[model samples]
Target chain A: MRREGSAFQGVGAVFIKELSDNISSVRMLMLELLIVLTAMAALYEAIIALRQNTAEDPFLLLRLFTVSQAPLPSFVAVLGFLIPLMAIGLGFDLINSEHNRRTLSRILAQPIYRDALLLGKYLAGLATIAISLTALWLLVIGLGLIFLGVPPGGEEIARSLAFLVIAIFYAGVWLSLAMLLSIVFRSPATAALVALGIWLFLTVLWPMLAPAFAQMISPPDPRYAALGLDTPDTAIWTQLLQRFSPNDLFGEAMLAVLSPTTRTLGPVFLDQLRGAVMGAPLPFGESVMIAWPQTVGLIACTIVLFVAGYILFQRQEVRA
Target chain B: MSDQKPEGGAASPDVVIAARDLTKRYGKTSVVDAINFDIAKGEVFGLLGPNGAGKTTTILMMLGLTEISAGRVSVLGFDPARSPLQVKRRVGYLPDAVGFYDHLTAVENLAYAAKLMGLSMAERSQRIVAALSRVRLLDVANKRVATFSRGMRQRLGLAEVIVKRAEIAILDEPTSGLDPQATLEFLDLIRELKAEGVSVLLSSHMLDQVQRVCDRVALFRTGKIVMMGSVAELAVQVLGAGFVVEVEADGAGIARRLAAIPGVGNVETLAEDRFRMTADRDVRPDAARAVVAANGALRRLSVDEPSLEAIYAHYFQASQSGGVRDAA
Candidate 1:
């Protein structure tokens, strides 16, 4: 039978409530603190390195995210590592906590379908990540201006903003993954542990293991190895394997956006670089075009994960 | 209480909820087998049964929170499965062990429900305060629910229903886990709801408490309703001998004289001065008159009223003995 009325009738209410709950939650606060401190430490190290170099590059502002001192990573690298953690923290308990608290049935009894609650919660998680990422982005820019004593060019500003948006999408991927786990596991602790385990495997193990796995599947050509050239088939296979991890997609997308000279994220043939200027930076639009596939990949991963969670939650019984 | 009950047939306008052949099944096992009942407007109907007796399953089916394997249920004239939002808009449900967000204040929690109900900001605050006051939770409106007791949380749940201004309230084991005083207080709130013309359908395993507030009750056994009607009617049906009258008196041959009264049967002497008998009707006046005429000193005379507890026990005992006495 057809259900009457819009399923989104209570979306606004659920969204507002979840947004406030996420922002005020103690776990969220701790995660936010960790992200800010680590990002600032990286940013400080980047500024020190940039100050010592006195580089005259036109994209010097963009270097704030990529430059690093010894024993410390760059601002973008720190964010790439921490964004997923924050997203998981925000969503690992999103649905199961309601079940544990015995409130799911009561809430579902309201004049709204499950669609509204799940959608609202996912949107709220995305919004929370967006707000924090934007704030952190602006803080970095402000610090760059004060410490470097140079105004950022319009392209640099545009590129960093693009990076900020990509970072939020990156967070959405992990948030959706965590929410899916929350729906699958009844215990919040179990969901959290499993989400963290997947995050570790994708971010740490996958990148290192992708090349070995790809080579095993498609051995490198002897002719290419003897000529001191990368094999085309193995490179393509490795890139495909790495693309399965959201971390790889997000990292590649950020790299393309923040470093305009980057033309491709995969292994390059000498012929592909022929006739290109040795160090000329691509235009802002061209950089975006280069990152477009990865950005879309991040968004697609988020949607697929969220849809999986939605289906599972819809079929779940409301009884505690 | 509305004495005019809408018997099994097409629903009357007075009926706020009607279930016809309502059934719920999991795989091959039917949890609720073709049970039918009606809740009239401004009346308190009870679904009484032990745990796992399909009471909760029936409640869930009515709210459309779970899939109905077969048959249909209408709440507020809308089929719950087809138009759940419409039915839910007018019906408030408090699931067993009703829960609230402990971190949120009572007002904040109720406000969320109010927003879900689409109440405007101005009306939301007004209704929230009014609901809290009605449930006697106004004093703790700003206190986090974690600091509140279980009874307070249950009251807060009731307040949420009040905020919705629902036409019908469905409570599943609302009084469970509450102290005797709290249970009484909660029942009073339910009575107040009935007084305000809100229909209530409450399910519970605690028979005595349900007997106190329910206008009519359906006794659920296994997946079917074994017996149903007002407490008095069920007593007459299950306990065919009817009312149990007790007399504390002093006289010669009082038991034999009490047995001679019209509509009285099976008089037995408990003590030299006490007697108990089964009567089809209230034989108190007749017994008193007979005792006075027989020159016996009448000290006390009372009847053991028909209680859901007795009816539930008698019906279950009879069924357990392999005598399936069908009384509905």
Candidate 2:
């Protein structure tokens, strides 16, 4: 009877078991629902504020819902930061905890391949993030309709969904990174620390420090520096520094979300400074393409890290 | 048990698991080196050794968890290195210090393992019940494993492995933490599997348990199998050459006189008036007559064959000396 099923069916069975086990836990369900509810409330309050104001600018509401009159940069900024933490939190102990429980070898002894174990964990983590983010997005859209007197247009909906995908992929990258660390390190606490440290370096410290470090170490060649203090060369160097960070990719993604017209940094920054910001909304597809390089880089890194982890785990002896 | 002969041979069935010149090295030190042996189908094979004697390393190589540095291993007609999934599917393993999800109930843990083994919902439920019942833990199937006692967890671990009805069960110290009663029950469960034609390769430090259950045992020391064969066979071939004679004699006075005899190797006073005489040859008759002639009345007379424990000690001593000789 066991021989009748395909390999993928076996993998799917394990994946579903892991997913159900994770979601069925009271603590995990409460934590995820709380996050979704908080994001919904925040989105609803912004939409309500926009509706009460009688502003003439057509984008006054969009800007208010996204960027302007907020506690921080934008809704995207909050999501960009919070989503990765959620991803890491969900996956940091996925593999190591199995080892700790002494069930890793027992599970591997079954017919399932090592790939199944890793893929099951990855899918479970991604599914949790997707479900939470979807719930939040739906609530926000529902609130937007209730408060703003109308539903989002086709382009607005597409742009918001695109942002959500970017957020999901960003979270997935962190999840893979955390799982890789979990396999490499023995202790769950240590794995979490390593994952959080990488997150902090990429999101907070790298953006601030990479530019300074590049300037100090290899300040644009004097020949290029002398042409102008703030030429395209300087902007190129700054962007190059920003390119080293996943957060910069997220920040660019957020900019594309809040003001659709702001696709490229040169035009976006120039328009913002000159107070000549075009009212034309950028297409969601174009915005995603602009962040495609960082997205690809992060996704590729995730694959490499996870494959290394898989190999290490396959080679590790479960003696203890 | 049905006396069906395996396809290979009756004396030594086709090797279900074979390791030849197998070696595993961690960096500079070899944990298992050139260890050669075979395990036959339906036989309860034991890998017996003291701690750090490479028993676990050999098992890990068989499971393909640890890469072999040299030599080769074939498990059930599949190369463990190349076809690990195939080999693993046919083998159930309980690692040392078996641990399961503390948050999950025993039934859930077994069901998860069964699903991993590709069992359907109905099959999983039936197998889980059967396995738990075999391990005598069906009553606590619904309770979370975190609250289980050590012995209960061990039993649950056993249930998880057998739930799939794997062809070969590899257990590493399955009864290490079990109490005497649990150990006996676990041995009975193993015996049941043997009756059902399932092969078992158990590694353990508990020599007495291994001696009782294993049809054959491989004694490992310092990364190699120094001795390997059936316990009865080994005792007969190695220690069986000598006979132990217990007789009521004049304590140390008779013991010293027996030691001086031509064929007798040594004699020690066991109790108040009894003496145990070990002879290089079968000199029990002559020694008994000698004791009777020397003002001694034989209260009890018996010629004893060497036991598994004595053979184990003998082989370990020989292996240690062999290792030292090789070093020199």
- TM-scores of chain A across candidates: 0.97, 0.83
lDDT of 1 by residue, B1-328 (tens): 1112334433788888888898988999998999988888899999988899999888887787889998877777676777778778888989899889899999999999989988899999999999999999899899999999889889999998999999999999999999999999999999999999999998999889888999999988889987888888888899886688999887787888888888876888888899999987888899998888888999999988877777778878878776544432
Per prediction, the TM-score for chain B is 0.90, 0.78
Docking class of 2: acceptable
- The per-candidate count of clashes, in order, stands at 0, 1
DockQ (Cα-based) for each candidate: 0.60, 0.44
Write the residue-wise lDDT of candidate 2 on B28-127 in tens digits: 8988989887888898999988899998888878887767899887788666666666777788888888888888899988888887777778998998
For model 1, the superposed segments whose C-alpha errors exceed 4 Å read B1-10, B250-257, B260-262, B269-273, B293-295, B323-328
Best by DockQ: 1
Given candidate 1, what's the lDDT at residue A159? 97
CAPRI level of candidate 1: medium
lDDT for each residue of candidate 1 in A98-200, tens digit (9 for 90 to 100): 8999999999999999999999999999999999999998999999899998999999999999998899899999999999999999999999999999999
